[model samples]
Target: MNIDHNDEAIVIVGSGAGGGTLAYELTKRGLPVVVIEAGGYLRNEDYVNDEWEAFNQMAWLDPRTTSGSWRIARDFPNLPAWIVKAVGGTTTHWSGATPRFKAHEFAARSTYGRVDGANLLDWPLTLAELEPYYDKAEIAMGSTHTHGRKPLPANNNYKVFANGAERVGYKHYSTGPYATNAEEYDGRPASIQDGFNFQGDKNKSKWSTLVREIPRAEATGLLDLRPDSQVVQITHDPTGRADAVLYLDKDGNLQRQAAKLVAVAANSIETPRLLLMSGSPMFPNGLANSSGQVGRNYMRHTTGSVYARFDQPVRMYRGETMAGVIADESRHDPDRGFAGGYYLETISLGPAFLASFAAPGAWGREFTEIMEAYSRTAGLWIVGEDMPQESNRVTLNTSVTDKNGLPVPNVHFDDHPNDTAMRDHGYRQAEVLYEAVGSTGSHRTPPYPATHNLGTSRMSARPEDGVVDKWGRTHDVPNLFISDGSVFTTGAAANPTLTIVALAIRQAEYIADELRVGGI
Candidate 1:
């Protein structure tokens, strides 16, 4: 079980949804894996329910710079994303919504056609090709409203949201396809309905790599899950094959771990950052920058929120943070003045987050009134497909360095015309939905630091168009793979965690088979 530096082990960076799941899958198949994670391991019992305290404890607060015309730049200039630096990555902080991507979403270029200033591309694979893996991921996550799993009970927030949806003439509204448990399954207990699903599910009922995949992988005795080990660079051999990795251990010591193959799953921002940092004479642009698409075409899913206040108390923060979803608007319609679609899903923030994010810099009576009406507020988030732009990207900012003296990632974004139109349509539709439920007043919240960061290294059938191929293997480096949301060719309307899990599952199978045949 002790994999030495020279052992034939697969080194996976960033133990999030992708790396964590891939570690388990490969280890379960009798392959040795070394999972290098940047943050320390925090168990379910270690999670704090308080919002601000939990954010400090689990968030990746390392130095990052942002540049864009997007409102996030004006509001939260330093924090470009709200992902975790813990063992489970953002899965510990996710809302547990697990909606699958629509079939048309895979072919965004073909379905939506070309829009001005949008860099749209069709995915290498289709929904049909990933369906079986989706099923496997859903079952593994114990997703509600799928595979005979009972749905989570509708809370008061969902009741109001669903009622509004029905009144608005929407057809599909449900309390699930969510990943939280309705009853005990997979050895994890049923949800206690503690409403702390966002601040790390302490109950162990919600699916996260910390609760499920990492522990299972550890049990196999083939996974060397090294926490607090920050992977810095991937080294390649003379023939351009990745051979080893250099990382900073917990005590600030540099360590080298040899690898038969390397898989980077360090989220979209850090994944591209690591690849860019590994640049050498053989591959000057970056490790996988033969297409110059290593950090281009970034998509954060055009996002916003609508919070409505009612006469009676709604107590939106009673059960799950995100459970109910209305999928009627997730269809592609050119008449909507946008290329891709979006989803209106229930979202409840604690009083602190609501006050801070409902309106970032508003003051005086308006902000105070929103705080006072917290008990009677029902809110839903607008998550839709944001167009990929060639200019929006993550690049290394050598001016700002982290504690390790490594350059931090500078995320630059600009809203495409399609993104702006889609967000506006979503806000109007959300107001209509809330109005149908007799809401006294409504407030529109601008997009927060993105939780769903995707498509810096996209998948493409041709090598010149993207960083990875259909199997997630980097087109330039046969022994290097990108096992994260960065491989998404286009952002879909659905929550991205489920698709990320499915892709990791499929990637694992391919990796194991290729290894068996000595192909990489």
Candidate 2:
């Protein structure tokens, strides 16, 4: 498994929260690393003031180019799934709602009993075990919200919801920690509360993983970042260990990069796709697919939106996409007749183009009236937990191919009955809050596609049920690891960026320890 240069380096596939954090941790410990990102580098100045343009620049927009994109399915017709392919990945456009999964979330199956047709399992690690890493990730990302800190300022939106939740006897409080700058902890500039809107000039800042960790990794002189390199496959040796990677350069020229340890941080979809594509006699099903679980257990938090037209302007466009969150209904309580949890948050309604799509009205004069009334309206996003089902999986589509001639991932997924029930509970609760806020009109938005996809390459204690072990090491391939949301065993009812960063940090320590002991 020797290469021309015979260089030994840790190769990471993506530069999102997981990959970037891993690179930072490993390089800080004086380990050499190579990070490959499919998108080019972008700065804060590149972010514009138009929501549509900002979304396009921050995410994968085109349908054709993203035909084989992760979670963008042809099977589910009206669902809108958003994914990013840039250097910083989807973190560039993330709403920055950083909430830690509850302690019970790790043991949902054991606590709430078995979910039919679902693979609900407790996490190998507990929340207490990962709390330190969460704190580190939050500090590193300059998270602004005061969740585990002192009393936070209650915005008008938060007060309205909290008051309503208390009146209804729901145990609601503000625990939604955001990954934005609260104060100048790092060398970066302090957060300006005035510029909280997604497309406002004041919202500009360098807060992404690329902006934080990649620069530090580069300064270490042990990490090499190669943007615009699309990884095609992982090349393995006769012993079934990943030795190198085949990728297409920016100019579309095929090239190879050798490494001793390969970290597949290519998100949930692309990671499995890459592994399945790297087929050989030793791994005919796919690399590390002996258990046939490389792309199983796919899960995403089912999201619902509650729109309300208040008598007075709620000033929806004044702050970040996610400025406040409600956690009263976000804990799993089996006595509630549902097997999942949900969280509520106040989000911005972008300008005309984006707002029309999110809050669309029927055609004719009604549509015009709804559009005119949007100036006095605001809404809340209800994100509910979806149980991990083995039937909801991501397998290769032999019949479908991408522009690069690679087989696209076939995503077969549907909501569980419990998930729908949880959503209904959230919707009803949201209606109560909206009515309490003196809303003239209120309606629940239809179920749309979720961006927080997880559990394609889950982590378990044994290889019989997961692609990676508790430490995220591949079962079949030693020296190969996975560090991303794909490794989640259960999908918690919260945003996953902070959790992914914590896992990456923990994985880096494990890899570092193994390297020190000459153990793969």
Candidate 3:
């Protein structure tokens, strides 16, 4: 019952939202899949309720360097991303907000017009084209407020958020469209409101790959889920098609897995790093770098945080970490002093994290005063569409070698003017919302380690424009694909999980049809 190293199987890298969902979908369709995860397999019960403890257990702690004008370089210099490395990937630690990309978001290039210092391109596919997959993804994830699924009850934080939005005359505020179940639909229980999910949801109430896709995939017996298998390179035949993957196992031994098809879903940084590392005579630069776009146009959504402290206790952390969202500003209005827009969603951080991220190296009366108002704080995250620039990218730091003696990936970024404008506008609007609710004071926190990493392997209508085609197939290497946020054309003003899952589902359907007709 073991999959041989020489099996003509579909090999997938990374087991996050995209890869895990694809594995389940393809396995159910009766195809063989080998999912190689670079971290250990931890079940729901293994999740730690404590914030710092859980962070140590799940966060991708690999050595990564950050070089950017962004505040993250000054705050979290070593940790560029706050993603999980475990079996379920970052889905085990996401906030579960499932907002769909707006129709205009797909055509950002044409809709927003040309902005200086931005490498904007319209996505090859539109919202209308992917709407059906989004529906299927929502149904599969049992997303609340969609397809008859019940919405989650508003917590104290949400009540405050909704009140503030109402006072500010803003619409489109809601408790869901979230992937977490509200009334138990897919064998997982409803959210118990324990509020430890951002740490790691131990209750199994939240939907994650550990609680859903990975298990369903295992049940089909067509899955070979290998944890602690860090891929070093992808091997290709003289014909320039991917044929094998070279990885280092947990025991520090190198192993090669033969494949008929290879899907790279190792997030944005690692996915492109692997592609760049897998250089050969056929591809002097990298496997999919013929367009010179393998590691370019890298983007992390424009982000900031605002916390308002009122006179009375709101106990924001008593429920979900992120419970509600306000979509009023998630639009493109040139008069607003920005090219694109953002969303304001309720966010709660445990005291330890707040102290660390709210102000990285601050101490004194000002810092102490902020921490003292934890019980009275109502916080919101501003996630906006950031312009993608060709210079904002991930590159191999040949100067730094990893544990396996391979050059480590260095993430380099510089915030575009559009990003700064968007963030400033979002922050100003947030202050108005809080002031509308009679808040005594508000604190604005700079960007933290990125969670919504996108691009680096984007889709394009032409081969010279990007790394992948609309179907996520590599332009230079036909049998190779990207199945994560790496394939995002432009980062829309929404959480990328739902879309990543939707695209993975769509890719699965295409791969299935192609396998049937020998197109691959």
Candidate 4:
């Protein structure tokens, strides 16, 4: 049944790890949900395995601008982020590494004690508070090496990475905490060892909101899923509560959906863009920008890559793209010349991507030489906590409008000193690891356009400090919420997808209870 435009229904935006999971959780509990996605739906059978072809089919290639001193500006000026715009969102393109946030990471401000040039804040809650939800999320996602799920087999790339890690004296290296299955669980089949995991898993072994949460939510018959609908504005009543959302359908016609409760999970950049665009007389600054913090404090985790060439043929791109993780460095030791630590995970890209990302603009000999050594190469990615700065932010660039004539978000970022230190350390350590296991040479690649965009509409303990509260409810608008990584207080050293899913699960429980008691 169609949810009428006048009916007060539960509405969610986007369909990624957060919004898609929240949709399933709420619908499974007998609540009706309407999910409006900005892109068209592409099923598992619809995925294209070729890297560049798949990228073109799924990437959010909208008109966006990038600024500040980040290398991405020089390399990919119009593509600030490499997120997917399809119905499942970026979850369709993630690497499937699901590491939990460490306990100390939740209390970063209290533990680190005031680093200069950082907007550090302790999470309103703690790891202990979220552990149970993490467990639930893990079980729901069928995370390997957790709750009786078996880990995926090690590929040649992981074998090489593990040997190097072992020679370097790293203790905690593993094939898991990954979300792909080694054996069938929860009706999804085991991995067929496909290297196209990054291009949307056609085999359905990897976990994505598209493969799991969305289908389950649809099965409940309580979901109204509308793809290719871009939300433009959230209209509010005179009492300052969100009442409706106005969006453009696939036909470019505007439609309004009345919402009793609205949850925005449109990733970090667009979530705030929508909120900022919704400014009215009641909320002159933005919907939840009473604290003037709607689009401030943007973070894309500190990232880079190290690829080494060896004498033997590793053929790294023969199995899962990112199945191995080295957790020994994922700690908070200031002795490492940085405030936080990083993870070194095995990664293997197709030859086309390897050439493109190995060196953005290199010449004939050096570039071709690297491509020629593809079979003999092994690589890993460095992902660490990047300090959030109030200056690094997403703002409206009215000069460049999107296809629908809306101002696109301009992402401005400058690497924090801590981020630089951590990246340098990661590079040195990766080189050492490769050398210890016999590498001829290694190349350090600058960060790609961000996939882990986070923290634009952060959560705070007090209303004056942030946009949302501990429950993800906007401090200025009670019925409005943010159910994505945009609400991250601090980006922990681990990946954000698992945490995003866990938070959505926890948020769903709270929202469901509030709905029952008429609390909103």
Candidate 5:
């Protein structure tokens, strides 16, 4: 199967937040767009009520050709990192905790100086530059949280941190903004706020880019979605410009999609892998690898969870994955000896079967007893900021191949000393919050394995420092663009979906403008 040269469609790979939003935005403006998603399309009915099933849905079942297994951290083996491959990508199973990156987050280098062994730099685009896009994304995705309108939510855990911050005379505010709908907008339902029981009932109002953008994009005849099409490589022209992508359809047929512009929306880990696989004479390192920054500067939002069992059941199961969050601490303070901020929030507890594995104590009668005791316990998560390091990188492991006979992403990452210190500080603060809430047996998960991956192809002003420019266009390959977490220069403490959507929306405008002008 081959797409004709005259198709007049922009080909987008990976239909997650970035690709999905791009497809919607472009098609709405009457640009023909072809979206290729490795994962099949799934509907709300496809979501199972069971925690294990829900967790499993977070990944692509086909191990080969997909990065499903590549997300796991090899060094520390027990933890499971979640990423999705379906048309919605990871947004389907995402915790739906959407918070905007702070204004200072975009200028970490200038604000806090610099850190050793880190590539902290000011984004080419400032918060004010992206603010309009953020608002556009919020409107497009039906974001829910109140921005600077009222004080942040005051759960028992956040109250403790707020009081401490107040006593210390530090400026603290609510987690600024969220993409989940605060009220019904754009025909999407309102966000329902229950306690910690996310598995209790499904909230249809929660806006996932899949549910929000894909449908809108599909309604336009300009957009066509091809699910289960695994892209193998990008085809580049002699000048090192990507002109098309080569992929395999579900029937194992080779297909080449030619587009004047190509956007790689695969997430941080896979985006770089795709580029590296697309080798050419003009780009021996890889397509768009003139600076050798294709797969560098890897980062993930390092997270730590503090668990506590209350005497009275706090209704541990209730609403979304993260219903309420404490944003007062989401800022970097060099005086505190750390360059990271943390967003603290409550998390869902798995059902009995999965809870058995998380339960403390040895795998004997003691473990069983512990499981019984904490079955209804509530937990808090400290999603902390991570500084992007060039060394903590993603490279293709030729020795390892998944089911698709493709090399898996070999991720090499270790927490920087300051990162570890920030995590420790956040853990101590979480312990304090638990104690303040009158909970016993509060403890942090031992060194969380990286899951929220970002920054593999960081965006900057120049090709020397990053893979993409401020507009998400590759510096080396002018026609090739990236729209995903991979373009982030810094990983904020917040869940990255909202920011990813905002950036994709911003990229869409740039692409639309370039198309209008017939410019590369």
Candidate 6:
């Protein structure tokens, strides 16, 4: 089904949850696709369990500057996004939480009221409209506790965490809704409950595109998965329809892949940066920057962490990285002193990351004491909805260039008052949550480099508001699309991967149907 002729195949950039899922879906439907990824095709067996070793192996450690009022600017000044630059993208490093977005979260603009200094916009599509796709994505990903996928067994960390949740009167605490397999399902084996998997799950229990979609797509024989192909520019014809993608191959040689349609799923930072770098005379600002919103409204979820030291050993790092989540706080209660909400997820950072992130530049007996009590520490991450500020954005810094002499991206973020308030509330709630478990004391870790980068080319109902429409097709260029978190209109409390896959599945259907009808 590799349709031949003058027209190019559908080109999908960045083979992560979104792009990889789209490739499998489209190819399985008899449509040919060419996926170009910037990272190497590291297999499941090639994964390293060591903290720093895995970090070096899979992280997108390119030169990107950070400048903002956020602590990450002062702490991790060189790394803005903690995403991966491989075939599976950040799915390789994700904890596999797959909770769905609440209905109200979709209509943030209408529900959250007009918050000052926030560029809030309701998504072009609703959860009700996407519910079927969400179901499909869950089935495809084998999300635990969904579609009869068994819940992952609770380890000691979750046992401690759940007991605390119960004592604190939080109702929605559980072992899963995660994508990692609890039992043998979909040809993937059950989890081994090893601590080192989060850096990169070698056992293949975690649902990642590299483990699932890419193999299936390749088996279909209609998909071409090219690794180490860093797409730099999206070129267009005179009519402003995306016609081809120019990328640097593995050998650092320039190459161009003609495209019948183009989908940019290059995470949040690189997606907008690529667009800005591809500016043409027709679209001076960027390829799809007609609304001047391509690089604006950047959102990384408001995040923080609380680690507590108990009298006895908790050994939090003995099981899955994020084993339990307390969802009681993930609600719209502005009376709690914030417009949005956050979830308290059980998190475990290996000693290396813990020491580096727990206290960036601290020294003394107190810091040494915290390090010494690593085995007795229990950790919980605060993941919350962050306001999309017009000022928080990803822009190319011409002052700094990459290996290819291209301008490196400069991420600028200033926490909104709402973000600050919500983070503070989350920290307070987390400390209290830990206290419920009879913890001696706790330390709140500042936000690390962003894991859930979102909304750099957001979806909006109006052309004047964003880069893409409901189906992820760019409003300015009909054939261009955004298939990653970059298309998120508002950053919801839930992790974005499940939604990204769901949206990509829905987008594939839309693109396939449109192609059949000559709409594209």
Q: Global lDDT for candidate 2?
A: 0.75
Encode model 4's per-residue lDDT on 444-511: one tens digit a residue: 99999999999999999999878898889999999999999999999988999999999999999999
Q: Which segments of candidate 3 are over 4 A away from where they belong?
A: 1-4
Top model by lDDT, which number? 1
lDDT of each: 0.93, 0.75, 0.91, 0.92, 0.72, 0.91
Worst 10 residues of 5 by lDDT: 63-72
Identify the superior model by lDDT, candidate 1 or candidate 6: 1
Quote each prediction's TM-score: 0.99, 0.92, 0.99, 0.99, 0.89, 0.98
lDDT of 4 at 149: 87
Q: Kindly report which residue pairs in candidate 3 clash with one another.
A: none
Candidate 1 residue lDDT tens string, 28-102: 999989999999999989988899999999999999999989999999999989999999999999999999999
Show how many residue pairs clash in every candidate, following the order shown.
Answer: 0, 2, 0, 0, 14, 0
Which rank order by lDDT, best down to worst?
Answer: 1, 4, 3, 6, 2, 5
lDDT of 6: 0.91
Model 4 Cα shift for residue 17 (angstroms): 0.4
Candidates' RMSD to native = 1.5, 3.2, 1.5, 1.4, 3.7, 2.0
**Residue lDDT tens for model 6, 73-109:** 9999999789898889998889999999999999999
* Candidate 4: residue 6 lDDT (0-100): 51
Is candidate 4 or 5 superior in lDDT?
A: 4
The deviation in Å at residue 495 for candidate 6 is 0.8
